[model samples]
Each structure stands twice: as C-alpha cells, then as structure tokens.
Target: MAERAAEKAYYRFLVLFFNCLLTFGSYFCFDIPSVLQEQFQGNLSCPNGTHYNGTGHNGTTECVEGLGMTPEEYNLLYAIYAWTNALVVIVAGFLIDKLGNRFGVFVFSFLTVLGSSVFALGSHFRGTPYLLPLMLTGRLLFGSGNGSLTIVQNRITAIWFKGKELALAFGLTLSFSRLGSVLNFFFTQQFESRFGIQWTLWGGTLLCVLGFVSAVTVSVLDKVGMKQLGLDGVIQQESKKVRVQDVRQLPLRYWLLVLTIMFFYNGVFPFVADASKFIQDKYPGYSQREAAYIAGAVYDSSLILSAAIGILIDYVGLRGLFAVGCAVLTLPAFALLAFTFVPPLVSTIWLGITYSFAAASMWPSIPLVVPQATLGTAMGLATSVQMIGIGLSNVIVGKILGTKSSELKIPLWRWQNMMVFMLANTIACIIVAVSLNIIDKKEGGTLNRSTKRSPTEQVAGQPADTASLLNDVDDERSIN
Candidate 1:
C-alpha cells in the first residue's frame, strides 16, 4: 500500500484529471453562438424555412425569439475569439516558458473567468447598444485565455509525461477539452429553454470557476510530484529566459507540423463554428435541437474514440503515415457533405474519425521534434498561426453567406460553395501531411518511432533520437 501511495503514475494521472479540466469553460462557451444562430438572427422556427405570419405558415420570417443579429455579426463573434488568440498566444507561450506552466495555468484560467463574466454581462444587456461590443470583448478574453491555457496544458504534458505515453496523454487532453464543446452543443439550447438566456449564459461563468479551481488543484499536485521526484530544480532550471530568435531555431520538421495544423484545422474548426446552422439549412427533417446534436458529432465522436487512437499511435508508430491517411480521408468527408444529398450524420462521423486519428498523431509529434526549452514557444507559434487561419476563414465564410435573412435558409448552392472552400483547404492539408511524411522519413523517422519497439528504454529518454534538452542548459532550469 505504501509502495502504491508513492507511485509517480498514480500522481501523474491525478494531475491529468484536473489538467483535462483546464480548458473546459472556454470550449463550452465558444460554440454558444453556433447553436443559437437562428434565434440570434431573429428567426423563431426549428427548421430554417418555417416562415410564419403570427397565425400560420406565412411567407415571412417570424423574428420573435432571438437577439436579431445579422449573419456577419453572428460570425464575427467567432472571429473575435480567433483574432484575440492570434495576437496574444505567442507572447503567452514565451511567458509560460519563462514563468513556468504552474503559474501560467492560473493566469489563463483566471482570464477565462473574467471573460465569461463579461460575456454573461453582455447577454444580460441583450437589448442595449452595448450588446455586440460586450459580447466581442468577452469572446476576446475567452479566446486569449483558452488559447494560452492550451499552450500551458501542452507544455505541462510534455514536462510530466514526456517520452512516455505522450501521445495518449495528448489524446486524453483533447478528448477532455472537447468534452466541453460536446456538452455545450448538447445542453446550451436546453438550458436556454428551461432557465432563460441570461441564466444559461451565466452557467458558462460557473463552469469557468470550475476550470479555475481545477487549474489550482493541478498546479499543487504538479509541484508536489516534482518535490517527491526531486526534479523541482530541473524544471525551473531548463525553463530559462526565452529570446525571439528561439522561434527561428525551431526545426523545419516542426514548421511542417505547424503548417499541417494551419491548413487542417481551418477546414474542421470553422465548419464546427457554423455546423448547426449548416445542418438546418441542408437537412429538412431535423429540428434545431436535433441539428445541434448532429453538429456536435464532430466533438462527441472524437471524445469517445481519440483515446483509443492515441493508444494505437503510442504503440504502433508511423504517426506521419497515420496523419497522411487521416488528411486524405477528410477530402471525401467534405466531398460527400458538399455535393451529395446523403444524410449529414455520415459525413460528420467521417470527419470525427479522421480528426481523432490525425490529432492523436500530430500534437504529440511536437515534443518529439523540438527540445523541451522551446516546446511552449513552438506550441504558441503554431497556435497563433492556426488562430489567424481560422479567424480569417470565419470572416471569409461570413462573406460567402452574405447578410441576407429573409427566410433564414441558405440555398443549397451556397452550402456547396462553402464546402468547396473546405475541400480546397483539406486538399492543401493532405499535401502538407504528405510532405511531412516524406521529410520525416529523410530525417531518421524520429516521429515514426514507437515506444512499444523500445521496451527496455528509460522514462527520461524519448522514442527516438531526442536532443539532450536538460543537459544543454545549466542545471538551474527545466522545462517544468
């Protein structure tokens, strides 16, 4: 019993429990607009084409039960989140590396609390002129906090689980974080129906408080583990002052990984942002609630399946090949969504499967290619680039949809046009994934090495040739 009490694996997973909760609030609040699109756009029907004249099915928008924002305004909420993260996350990364992820977690989580509060306030004043501005501000804060919190989470994972179960750890984090998104889609509409919109919005703020408490808990657990393991100095020592030049030192392989995420997520996330409304537009039978459920399949499927794929990638090796295959699959997934009249559930599932596979392979690959000292910076850089792409994509989508809301139903042709853009982005993502595979092979396949192949290896070493991150720096700093 004493032996088990002292086990590092036991404590590590304890920390993982709270680590997974760190970003829950941001994700939960992030997609509120997507699920609430019709109401916010001044329509009162479940299906998009339910034109009512106050008595029956008349050929006019009812405009009774939402905030009445335009389509451009609806999409701008998402754009603000992405844009804020694009500007702030890179700097936040450097600071996390310099100050330590223990503290970084608190800072980012606190930001979420503040942001969510302001957002609730915005919703509270829904009829005022301040509504849009406050909402944008709240999203701005939430985006920065969530984005930086992700950087810290990735860095924390590397610090604690590096060279062992790294991919699985990452998969767990993704599954857990996205659980927030899944819950939002599942419950936001229900909450609004039961307790009114203001209370529903406040619920997100309450979740942010949970996130903050979890952040503090994980930090305490991590510090205790470091002391027990005698690595407090090692962590602090390696996490030294970072320089802007360090960004340039990140390898070409790392940059390629960044490129893969940039193009790939542009297809997935922007779509998720608008998926509920999209489903309502194309499919005739589903209600808004049912459409929200179908849209959330992207996260729900991933929540259940990504950990299994992570375990597979952890043992199977060949992550690059896995990435290539996943990227290629998204092409057909988007094609079916774009051109065919088949049920959208099938395409959503296809997307979720491919996303789970690719994420399990891709994110863990970052620690393999770069030294620990630069991990936070690399993550931040990648996140910033991704935010830029996603933000612009939201804007571009807004432009495509235009500001017309007579019937609240976008034509099938416009839906196809949007899918075409996603398909093109997915094609680029596949090209880059292929490029990443070719480049990784030429460079000794560090990313393709599996831990199962090295049963005798120590926990301190990686699956392949990794730089001696701790040794290169003074004994004063560690990636912790």
Candidate 2:
C-alpha cells in the first residue's frame, strides 16, 4: 500500500513536470523573435551623435534599421521556422516509436539547450554575416526539439489520464504554455533592456536546461510509476510485438478534426510571432514594447479561456460544440480585419477572446478520436499539416502587405495585412468546421452499423486471421 501511494505521487509529479517543461519551450517560440529585434537594434546603432531620423533607437527602428531585412525577408525566415517545426513533428512520430518517450524527450531537450546557447552566442556576434546562418541553425535544432517534446507530451498525457480528465489535463497543459508566452511578452524586452540581447537568448537557454532536467526527472518517475502499477515489463514486451491493424486505424473523420486544428493553428501560431510588430505599425502611437505586451496578452488570454472550453468539449461532444466555437471565433477575427481603419484596441481584445474559445475546443478533442498506441502518429500528422498552413499564410500575408496599397494609395503595412489574412483564414476555418461536422455524422453512422452487425456477418465480412489481428490490437490497448 505504501509503494502504491508513492507510485501515484510519482506519476502525478511526472505529469506536472512534463507539462511545465513543454510550456516553457512553447513560450520561447515567440520570445526568440522579440529578442532578435532587440539585438538588431543594438547592432545597428548610429555612427555619430547625430541620429538618423528614421533609424534612431526608437520603436520603428527595431523593424526598419535593426533587422535590416525587409518585410518579405522576415516572412521568409518565419516560413522556414514553421516548416522546420512541421518536419520535426513528422520525424518525431517515428523517433518516439523507436526510442520510447523518455529517451526521445531527453535527447530533444538537450538539443534545445544547445540550440538556444548557439543562438545566444550568435546574437552577441551579429557583426559577422555568419550570425544569420548560426541563428537559423539554432532555430532548426530547436524546432526538432519542439516537435519531439510535443509528441512526448501527448503520449504521456494519454498514458496517465483518462476520459474527461484527459481533456482537462491537455487544456491545463496548454494553459501553462500560454503562461510562458505571457512571460515572454514582458520579460524578453525587459531582459534586453537590462543586460542585452545575448542575455535574453541566454534566458531561453537556461529554460531549456531546466526542461532537460525536468525530462530526466520525469523519466525516472515514469519507471517507478510503471513498476508500481505492474505495467513495466508488460508494456515493454507489448511494444516490441505491436503491429498496425485495421481496428487501430484512425477514421477519416479524425483527420478532418485534425484539419480544423491545423487551420486554427495556422492563424494563431504565426500571429503570435508577427503580431507585436504588426500592431505597432498599424497603431503608430503604441511603441513596439507596448505592442509586445498586448500581443502576449492576446495569446495568453486564449489559453486561459481554452482550459474552460476544453472541459466543455467533454460534456458537449466535438461535432456541434467545436463547430459552433469555430464559427463564433470567426466573427471577431473578421471584424478586426474588416475595420482596419478604426482604432484597433477593442478589436484586438475581441480577437483574443475568440481565438481562445476556438483553440480550447479544438486541441482537447484530438485524443477522443485517436487511441493511445497511435496517438503520436495522429498528432504528428496533424501538426505537420498545421505547419504547412502556417508557412503558407506567413508568406501570403507578407506578399499582400508588401505589395498592396490602401484606399488612399498609401502602402498597407505588414500588420494590417496580417489582420486581413487572419480574417480570411478564419473564414476558411468555418468551411472546414462545416465539413468536419458532416464527416463526424458519417463516421458515427458507420461505427453504429459496425457495432450492431450480427456476429456471423461481422466474421464473414473479414477473414478470420484479419479479425484476430484486430482483436489483438484492441486487447493490447485495453491492457493499459
């Protein structure tokens, strides 16, 4: 009894630790760019006491003089980052399957630490043209770690939680990650103002180190928990003999649900990175630092609301609840973009609220459709598809902003274009939601028929050997 209690405590600790580690890393996803802009400002310091009018150490300078890159260049860089994340998710599926979640998390966390350190070092030596390559290299490595960590988080959650509790767990985990984003909003600039951009990057490096330590601790706790539960050896042996079977296959409806998530993320993730500068450009009165604060609030607020909505998904079911959430989210997103000429503060706040509602519903619904054994693969595929949308949207928004002019013939700034792009993306999401509802109904009908069929008809429909393979897959999953 003592051992069992100790084991339960360990499992709880493992879940909390992994959730914190992943959330810390997610915060850095947006933090790095803000740090980069600060470093760019320091590097592009004026040559003399006489300040260059547009190139002075002010809010716009970070975007114009510091980065040296035009809007198009920055967009391309962001696309690369998004694409790298997508590839990492796809690769991590196989890596977790082979290495197990513990080993995979450790290896990936170590890579993140290294990548962040390199990025910090590169920021300090920005005079060298080589810094760009080094920074990109670091981002690529970090992306891999990010992908691996995502897969591991979902797998671990599926293992430790069940039913509606799992949805809450997932939602709460996301909420912590949003907390990181909130920290990034205020702290990144504060760090840059205090020590320098290098120190800011170093801060992320330190977080990565902490993540590595937490991952190792979780691995140890996981072993203890498994042994106490009498599942350690059983899981290992079963993993070796595991095979893909028809019953284990995810339905097409599941893929549609994933697609909806992909569309939502496509708008949200890139916006997190780009919105600060975009807002500053559009509003003009607000400083970049102020914009960053608002942007963080926007992202973090959604996470807070999402946790509540995630619980709602458990009671309401995905088909109607998620679809309605997506539909409602579109209204604010479109309103913000369509009224671009108006004061943006109100719209920004509304957009933030809408986004939170959609996200809270969408992410929690994934595990309901996919079983544990194949959860990693399903999430990987879903994330990869999301990245594709993110990458494309970044480029498209960049082009639209860089090329188009407003009604007055003034060139529409990048941020304004981004808002327009987000509005359009939200509209696309509505269509995806409608399609998903249709697919869900069809899948439900099919499952009902399959379950109600006579035993002889079920046996005759599939060969005896194939039916046995299906049973084995289900049995192994049930053993958990």
Candidate 3:
C-alpha cells in the first residue's frame, strides 16, 4: 500500500511535467519576430543597382521602395498574434471546459503546427505581393492555437495539484515556458544567419510539432491515471456547464486578479516584442546579435528564478504582497533602462526578477478564488483581457515610433518614449496590486493563506493511509 501511494505521487508530478511541454512552441514562436526584426526590415541586394535596406527600427523606413513593406507593416505581424489570441482564448477556454483537455489540446496543437508552416512559407516569398498577407494569416492561425495553450496548462495543473503543490506546479511550468523564450533569443539569430530566414521559421515549426506530441502524451497519461486513482468519477461529477452570467458570480478578488494580470502583462509582453530592436536602437554601437543577447538576459533570469520563487511562495505564503512588490519594481527597472545610462543588462535583470515574481504569485492565485468546476472559464477570461492589453500595447509602441520626426535618422528618442509608456503601465499595476492586497485582507487573506483540510474532510472518501500519505507529502505546508 505504501509503495502504491509513492508511485501515485511520482506519477502526479510526472504528468504535470509532461503537460509543460505543450507551451514550448507557443512561447518560442511568440518571440521569433524579435530576433528576426532586423533582417525583416533589411533589404536584399537584388540584380538591380538600387540598394533596399529593410526598414530600420526608427519606423520611418520606406516600405514601397524596398522589401515591399514598411517597418510598421512588419510591426503588425507581432500585434496580429496578440489580437487574434485575445479573441480566440475566450472561445478556446470554453471549448476546453466543455470538450475536455485532450480534445482541446489535440485540435489546437494541429493549428499551431499549421500556422508555423504557413509562417515559414511566407518568409520564402519575401518580396512577393503575397508575402505580408500570408504571414498575417499564418499568425492569425497560430494565435488561435497559442492563446489557449497556457490556459489549458493552468487547468491541468489546477486539476492535478490543487489544494497542495499548486503554486509550485504553476511556477515550474512557467519556468519551462520562459526557457523556450530564452532559447529563441539564443538560437534564432544563429539559424537565420547560418541557414536563412526560412530555416529560422522552420525551426519554430519543429518546436511546435514537439509541443503537440507532448500534449498528446500527457492527455493519454492523464486519462489512465485518473482511472487508476479512482478519482475519475469525482472529477466528472465536478465538471459544470459554465454560463455567461457566471461572470457576475465571481468575487471582487477574482476580478482584481484579472486586472492585475492585464496591467502587469501590458508592461511585460509588448516590451519583449520590441526588446531586441530597442536594445539595438538605444545603444547605437551594439550589433543586432549583441542586442538580442542582452534582451534575452531578461528571459534567462526568469528561466532560472521562476521555479525558485514559486517554491518560496509555497513556503512563505505572501503571494499578494510579492505580486505588489514586483509590480512596483517594474517602474524603476524600465525607468533605468530608458532614462539613465545604466547598462541595459542591469535593467533586464531587474525586469526579469519582476517578471518571475509576478508569474509565480499571480497564476496560482486563480484556483483559490474560483471553484474547480469553472476554472477553465475564469482562466480564459483573464487570458483574453491580458492578450488585449498585449495586442494594443504592441500597436501603440509602433505608432509612437512612427510619430517621431523622420529627419532624426537614428531615432534614439523612441526607446525613451517606449520606456515612458511601460513605466505608466507599471504605475497602474501598482495601484491594482495594492487594491488586490487590501481585498485579500478583507477576505481573510486567501491570497496569502495556505489551505488546511479538516480531519474528516481529509479521509472522507479515501483509504486511511492514502489520505495521510498525501497530507505528509504536503506537510511542509499547513494542512489547509
């Protein structure tokens, strides 16, 4: 019996770990444009005597004279993903809840693969009239799949690790996802310069396929494990039909969590979309490759720190406060990057720390506020709002650059303006986080409170030793 219990514990974590691979593609694809931005805006020297240099970061590069499109057009590629995702996530979340994880993951994984393929094809037709529309269509399809990938992963974690180990599960998954982002920065340029742009996109295509395989594998294991553990029937019973009116049923704390997600991510994701280019433009001497490496440092730190912070949150139980602190830090971090001569690396480190803290504390907080039944709907809603912020911010940043005086050939001032925009976002986040903490205090500190099950509750439907074993596993935490 003891051996059986140990095996169950091991499989629980194994299944959760497998689920993390699903987001590898989405995370990788999301940042691919950042590394390739320089090349996209650069011109290919054809047989003609004219030299068409792709639009530089200043956003004023003439598209008609060069690579058939402008810098603003290239900028649209990133925003398209966010805008499409913002819309798709709500529907995908509902489907995941109604159809179950396996079906949802399977279908979306295929879409991701298809999108990547289309995107790769677009690169091959670079100078053609068809190129821009094809790439945008591909991104639209990719966004449809990528949007729900995170929400599904969260639902899986909540289902498998809820009531104990929830925060750590989320942290580990996020860490792995950020690792994909880190790897993109590290390898995107290498592949592009070594093989070509088409190959670089194909690299992302390969990752998408791998992520799909991971999702399918986990789906099978989850089904088998649920049956073996005899929790299948319980879970089935717990599943409910989510309704539109249910939004009204959520508490003030849940909405606050949503707002916090929106404001904080608005400060994070859009900034990342432009990080590599921003680095190059800000420091004129830095090469594109060096700028990519510097921008990637932020993801690197998040890759290393996310899981550790998650573990710390599990033990310390001050999630709300940690989130607030991280939000406040974003102001100074972006300020230093924009307003001062501080090394870009230094700003990235601070921003990376802030990023990890927000993710580690924020995601896990969702399960506490919503019931297990409606977890999918709640996650979807939050993700939709977050994506809207991300989408709009990308467009706004590009517009800001476009408005600058065209005579300033090197628009170093644009980076400063971008930083100002991010700083304002962080300021808004601080206000939201403070409000969330106050509400947490009123709600008996749910945000910081670790759960404890009653003696009767712990053993109500399980073997005596089995119940105790699970409790022992979570012993580091209070028994709630």
Candidate 4:
C-alpha cells in the first residue's frame, strides 16, 4: 500500500511538471511579438517607422504615412491586447472551476493555437491594412488561452502539492514561467534579426502547437491516474459541484488588491519591449540591436532570479520580502533615470536585479492571502487591474515623449520620463507593502492570543489520561 501511494504521488508530480511547462510555453507566444515589433515595422514601411514614438502617431514610414492613424492608434493596439488578456483572466477563473483543470487546459490550448495561427497569418500578409484587425482578433483569442492556462496551472500546483511543499512547488513553477519569458525576449529578437519579422511570428505559432500537445498529454495522464486511485467518481462529483458556484460577486477588497499589484508590475513588460530603443536613443554610440539585446538580458535576468526570491519569501514571510523587493527596485528606478550618463553594462545589471526582485516578491505573495478555492479568480482580477495600469502607463509615457520639444534633441530625457513613472509606481507598492506587513503582524498577534492559554486552564479543561472518564465528563458538561 505504501509503495502504491508513493508511485501515485510521483505520477502526480509528473502531471504538474508537464502542465507547468505547457503554461510557460504559452507565455512565449504572448511575448514574442512585442520584442519583434520593430523588425515588423521595417518590413511593412509605415511612415511612422516600426518603432513606437511616445506620441500617439505611428512613425512616418511609407506603409503608414497615408493611413491617417496617430501613434495613439498603434498604442491602442497594445492596449487592446492587454485588456483582452484581462478579460480572459476573469473568464478563465470561472471556466477552470466549472470545466476542471484537464478540460480547461485542453480547451484553452486549442484556442491559443488558433489565435497564434491567426497572428502568423496576419504577419505574413502585412501589406494589407485589414491585417491589423486580424492581429487584434488573434490577440483576443490568445488572451483566452493564456488566461485559462494561468488558472489551470495554479490549480494543478494546488492539487499536486500541499502543506510545506506547496510554496516550493509554486516557486519552481514561477521560475519555469520566467525562463519562458526570458526565452521570448532574446529568441524573438534573434530570430527577427536573423530571418526577418515573419519567422518570429511563425516561431510563436510553433510554440503554441507544442504547448497544445503537452497539455493534451498531461490531461490523459491525469485521467488515468484518477481512475487508478479509485477516486474517479469522487472527482467527477466535486467537479460538478465546482461548476455550480457564481464567482463574479467576490468581494471588492479582493479586486482592489489584485489591481494594485498588477498595475505596479506593468513596468516589467513595457520596459523590456522598449528598453533597447530607449537606450540607443539616449546614448548615440550604441546600435539598435545592441540596445535590444541589453533589454532582453534585463528581462531574462529578472525572471531567473524571481524563483530564488519566491523561495526566500516562503522562509522570511511576505512583509519582509515585499519591503526588500520594493527597496531594491527603487534603487534602479532612480539610478537609470537620474544617472543617465552611466555605462550601459552597469545600468542594465542593476535594473535587471531590481526588476527581478520586484516581480518575484509580488507574485509569490498572492497565495499567502488568497483562499485556495478562489485563487484563480483572485489572480485574474489582479491581472486585469495590472493590465489597466500597463495600458495607462504606456499611453502616458508615449504622450510625454511625443510632446517633448523636438528642439532639445536629447534621448536621455525620454528615459527620464519613464524613470519618474517607475519611481511613482515603486512608492505606491511600498506603501501597500508596509500596510500589509502591519496587518499581518496584528493578525498574528490576535491568533497567538486565541491559541495560547495558561497551563492551569489547559489542565482544568481536561482529565489526565482517564480516556473513558474524560468522555463522561464532556457528556456531563454538555448536559449541564
């Protein structure tokens, strides 16, 4: 019996490992395009150039010159992508609860593949203005898949690991996902530089296919494991009950917390996507490709370190971890923007570490407060709030750069504006962290008060080793 139990546990681990891999693979698809957008601009010839101008207008390249769209139009494209992703997060939470993780993974994987296929097709037909609409459609579909995968992956972790092991399992899962993001940053740029923009899109499409296959395989394994355990009927009954609950009315406080975290994390993505351009523009000596590489390195480094930070949080608790993360991030935010004259290597390394710590600290803290049953919903709500912040930040930053006096001819100031935004975000996060710490301390104090009783009181409440008499005493007390 013991051996069988051990074997079952091993298989469960295998299922979770593969599911995590699939979730990570899906993120690669989401990230590839943002990194490759500049290359895409070169191929299509928009008068606005492929690069984002902080103003609302696309650059004045041949393809987009007569399109009558502003940089804002292009910016809206990204906003739509972010908002769609947020919507999917909300939907995915409910769907995961209703459909079960296995079915949810399979469905979302198919949706993701379909979305990636559309995106690839749009990229191939870049000459057509209509392709823009197709691209948005693809993003919407991709969001659904991404959102579903997010919930299912968490559910898998919760089911497979429990008690002390749960935190470590979650940390490792996050680390793998971050690795995927790192790959997306570098590989997308490398592929675009080497083979042109179309290949980058195609690469994302291929990743989606791989993710789908892996998800399906894991689902099959999970079902077989369930039957072998002789708990298939119980699993079905629980799944049916899960499908009946209405999760939309979860408390406003939960949504607020989710939004606050998400909004602050926006700095990580936009910075990664545009850092190369910002760096090259600010420092005239550097090439665009070099800048992009630096930016990618920052993202990869941040993600690689996030896993370590998550484990640290499990040991030190959320308050200390959050305060440390915020403090670390504040340094780079100031250093990069305020001290623009520093060497690229020095700036990149600090910024990467800061970014890594912020993300690692924030993500792992989610499970500590959120109830296990509604973690997916909470995550979705939080992600949605974060997307709103990202969209606003992207637009505001773009506007600041667009409106800058062309007369100044300085690129460093553009990055300075971004730095100011990062600083503000960091401050907000810090305030929240401090508040959370205080709350945790108060709660801990209260719990200790409730649990700790005098030795005399404990003795008075129970008989010493007279098991039969103890039952009689308890019965007499109840009768009284």
Best by TM-score: 1
Ranking by TM-score: 1, 3, 2, 4
Which regions of candidate 2 are displaced past 4 Å?
Answer: 6-14, 35-43, 48-67, 241-248, 341-343, 403-410, 445-480
Task: Using lDDT, give the best candidate's number.
Answer: 1
Candidate 3 or 4, higher TM-score? Answer: 3
What is candidate 4's lDDT per residue for 193-258, written digit by digit as tens? 567666777777887788888888888876776565544554455455543243565543344345
RMSD to the true structure for each prediction, in A, is 4.0, 6.2, 5.2, 8.1
lDDT, candidate 1, 260-308, per-residue tens:
9888889999898888878877766566778888999999989999888
All candidates in order of lDDT, best leading: 1, 3, 2, 4
Model 2 lDDT per residue over 46-160, tens place: 3552121222234344212243444555556567666887888866765565457787778877877877777667665555687677777777777667766777777776566
Name model 4 segments beyond 4 Å from true: 1-9, 43-74, 226-257, 403-411, 445-480
What tens-digit string does per-residue lDDT give for candidate 3 at 148-226? Answer: 8888889888878765677788888988889899999888887777677788888899999999999899889888876
Q: List, in order, the clash count of every candidate structure.
A: 8, 0, 6, 23
The residue ranges of model 1 lying beyond 4 angstroms of the native Cα positions read 1-7, 43-64, 404-407, 455-480
Identify the superior model by lDDT, candidate 3 or candidate 4: 3
lDDT for model 2, please: 0.61
